[model samples]
Target: MNAPAPIRLLIADDHPVVRDGLSGMFAADPAFEVVGEAADGAEAVRLAGSLEPDVVLMDLRMPGMDGVAAITELARTGSPARVLVLTTYDSDSYVLPAIAAGATGYLLKDAPRDELLRAVRAAANHEAVLAPSVAARLMDRVRPPAPALLTPREHEVLTWVAAGATNREAAARLLISEATVKTHLLNIYAKLGANDRASAVAAAFTRGILTPGTGA
Candidate 1:
């Protein structure tokens, strides 16, 4: 049986030291072959087109045209090389846009050598890879925001409404004026984003602001 061909790579970073370090690391490993290097996004794009590497290890903040633009250009021009963003930035501002621009993976510069190697392998196979913090940030971005909290008084009014109590009945039971009950209900409606008594009760239950058998 024959061994698999080494995964070809292009390192793209503005800093010469970073490029040299990455090149040396990959060169030391038989699984990867460092084919070329670029100092900026535009050069990265040009080198990517010429080198025909299996993966491009990209840095986000280069001198011109940045990593996102390089990735975008590669995808736009239908390049077969997958991009693995190797950067120090894990913020949403950096991670989201890079992924959106067609990066195969996002790994922080602080990642361990084994982790980065695994990420590059994964990227070569066109799989998604993200640093732990970057994955958490992405999850937070995609997950829906929690519903606004309701005040205790609003909760009480909603509880009563859920229990099928009329505003007048609820007010009499609570020893408050009917108008006061109405005001509370109005506030409850606004808080729960409901238009009327029935909707308010339903919304409250759905949002866990009110539970069955709860009282005002």
Candidate 2:
């Protein structure tokens, strides 16, 4: 049987040195193939639209249009390629917007060479590739969603949980029994599509059920 082809990649970075470094990295890997290169966001989008690479290595700051805007545009244009943000900044501001803009992965520009390659491969496979540090910080944007759909009681419970309260503490704060708090948490998980407390918070944030500074 024949082996699968290497995943096609698009490199979008304004810096010639950075682009060259990345081109070399991808060229060395049997699992990856560099299909196109772009100096700015607009070029990135144009190449992505035409070349249809499996993954796009997006840079945050660029000429004409930024990576976030380009990524958003690609999503709006309904491009099939996955976006893997490669930025120097790992802040939530950039990370959340990238994710919201349909980026499949986020990798800091300082990431190890192998990790960057792995991230692109993972993204091409439709997985969310987040470095532990980047994910731990960025994914928090979606946690404890913005506080709209939750009842007042539910919000109270979430706040306590966010404050590192045990079930009994949450129960005491809400004047509810521990079992009742547990039940509410179960309900919250179901409603938020969360697998655990942290996920519940992340989902809530994504759904606007919890706000960032509301102490939830």
Candidate 3:
């Protein structure tokens, strides 16, 4: 059988050392071909257009046109090259915007060489890959807004119930009638796909609508 083509790579980083190191690493591997190198996002975009690399190792912070902007431009132009973010920042500020700008993968600079290589390959295959920290950050922010699933009053009712309050007690605290409390509880159960109050609370906890130590 014919051998598969190497994964063409464009290394983009403001640091010369980082660019050289990554280029050398990929060059030494038969599976990857280092097609070009860039010291900033603008250069990276330029080289990407010309070289048409399979993957671009993009750094989040650069002097001109940060990685996020470059990714946005590449996406706007519909470049075929997939961007795999390799940066030192795992904070939500950096991770969210890069992914939003069409990055195929996000990996920290401290990632093991093997992991980085795997991430690049995944990006080239059009698969989504995120570093553990980045994934956690995304998970924290990606939860459906509680208000979307439950109204303010419904949330208050559920919170009281989760705190072990009876319908009458919740109603008294909220200045509503017991009947209204029961109505809210039924709505909560249906929305949460739970059969009873306990399951509703459990579902709320699982969905991050309720925290462990929170109470009425």
How high is the CA lDDT of each candidate model?
0.91, 0.88, 0.93
Q: Rank all candidate structures by their TM-score, best first, as comma-separated numbers.
A: 1, 3, 2
Query: Which regions of candidate 3 are displaced past 4 Å?
Result: 144-216
Q: Which candidate achieves the best TM-score against the true structure?
A: 1
* Alpha-carbon shift of residue 25 in model 2 (angstroms): 0.9
Report the candidate with higher TM-score, 2 versus 3: 3
* TM-scores of all predicted structures: 0.71, 0.65, 0.68
Error of model 2, residue 182, in angstroms: 34
Report the error of model 2 at residue 19, Å.
0.3
What RMSD value applies to candidate 2?
A: 10.4
Query: How many clashes in candidate 1?
Result: 0
Cα distance off (Å), candidate 1, residue 47: 0.7
Indicate the residue-level lDDT of 171 in model 3.
100
lDDT of 1 by residue, 110-160 (tens): 999999999999999989999999899989988999765876666766677
Query: What RMSD value applies to candidate 3?
Result: 5.6
